[model samples]
Target: MAKQYDVLIRLLMLGDSGVGKTSMLCKFTEEGFNSTHIPTIGIDFKMKTLMVDDKKIRIQIWDTAGQERYDTITKQYFRRAQGIMLVYDITSEISFRHISKWLDMIDEGAGSVARILVANKSDASALRIISKEEGQTFAREKNLAFVEGSAFSGDNLDEAFEGLVKIVMDRNKKDIDEQLQSIKLYGSRENSTIDAEVKPGGCCS
Candidate 1:
């Protein structure tokens, strides 16, 4: 049997309410964005396949409702997530300030998974409350990638997603390489049976 080349990466989008999480997901997955305020009641999900670094990656993106009551329900989706996007509204200082709590939730629920911080609504420079430099500094302090994007104008939205995919791929490659090295080291021993257990699901599903 030939080895399969399917790679699934689960990504979760989290942040305060009205930070454009749904818009960003729609823009990335379908290249469309709606201006209406149809808040996500529980969780909305979308999937897209892309070629990243010559590998076919199936990205399962989960957009969770930002309401306080949905925190418990949202946390359940974090365990298997390979990457997370901690987004904030660039025009709203309150939303931008709440990133710490969101990060904490990600850490507590997602086991400190790989994440990127994004400042949305970048198209409105005049109403911007969080500057690019500030967001970049904050992201660097937390060792997370940062980008200012706009789902409305489609600025840097694709880059933000592609960047996350690259991160996931790199980490997955490193883990596989480590396992292969361990196998090589142990398999060289005499009369040793390599009992490898393959998991049913990939990173996403």
Candidate 2:
């Protein structure tokens, strides 16, 4: 732990095909998106290390195939994820409508994980079908981090990932506190038991 990063964050990407999940991921890890079209087959991931709040962190980002056929395979990765990005095309109503299905998979696979709603293809305003207000409303209802991004033009990709890590870090801290409290409680019980059998001189008199 001392030699490497202080924490590890596993972020999973999910959404319909052609929503640019792969492209968005590439933008974050590579600082550029591939212009050539190539759909993700089953699953893939990228690892990047960063220094946040003076702590070293390694973010493992996983991208899953959006096709229904690969749902079973992709769901397996949700088990240990700390953050989840639900991406959708800003220009496709069908893709936006199907966000619920992807969200359901997360619930079943990575329940209670930190969630963010990404309105991708913000650069394509002419082809846009989903309004920014509509997306923001949905995110507000669900209490999720909301951001508009464009992988091709390089927009808020960094903000989206940064927001996710902050959420995960807060949760991780809470979990650690709970565990420490439990250990203290158990130790106190053991000490009480020992005291009950001994006299006042710190001996079994």
Candidate 3:
């Protein structure tokens, strides 16, 4: 039987508690959001399949517990992630401030994973403290893709995940191309060496 998906990507959600990481994941995967926020435990994952440019992609989004007590457990998931959403709540300045700390976590645990800075709760414009410019500026400074949207309204959620997927896929393609090129070069070099060592005749000659 054929595989269910052409590509499999593991994405991780990292943010402080109450930043709407779980809501964002649920909204993207389940197409619904709960107004009542229930804190995630150590870790939980949701799977969603999407098609990008004719390739079926299976995304496994892991939501990590934001509370400090679960920090150790959350760190273990980072290494395996192909992409990460560093989420923050627009209404909460503290949450926005914590994004840098989350970046530190990514640097330490995630290495070079594709990342996007997600500012959630855009529907709460009245309560929002972090301006769009600030989010964009920070994302630029950190070299991360940025998207500000609402899990409640479902704005830009699809773009956020799809953009990250595109980044990962492009990186994967580039890496594969580089490996193939290297293999071809090595083969050429080995063939040249063999031809040079072999005299104009048989091995016995």
For 1-205, candidate 2 gives per-residue lDDT tens digits of: 1335455678888898888988888878777667665777777777677877776667888787788898987877788688899999999998899988888778787889899999999999999899999999988988888999998987998889888888888878877455446555542121122213222211000
Candidate 3 matches the true fold with a TM-score of 0.84
* Segments in model 2 whose C-alpha atoms lie over 4 Å from true places: 174-205
Candidate that scores best on TM-score = 3
Alpha carbon deviation, residue 145, candidate 2 (Å): 1.1
Question: Over 4 Å off in model 1, which ranges?
Answer: 1-5, 174-205
Residue 24 lDDT in candidate 2 = 85
User: Could you tell me the TM-score of candidate 1?
Assistant: 0.82
Q: After best superposition, candidate 2 residue 190: deviation in angstroms? A: 37
**Candidate with more favorable, higher lDDT: 1 or 2:** 1
| Collision count of model 3 | 0
- Residue-level lDDT of model 3, residues 112-135, one tens digit each, is 889999999999999879999999
Q: For model 1, what is the error of residue 72's alpha carbon versus the real structure, in angstroms, after optimal superposition?
A: 0.2
lDDT of each: 0.79, 0.78, 0.80
lDDT of 1 by residue, 20-80 (tens): 9988888888777788877777676777888877755667787888989999878888887
Itemize residue pairs with steric clashes in candidate 2: none
Worst 10 residues of 2 by lDDT: 196-205
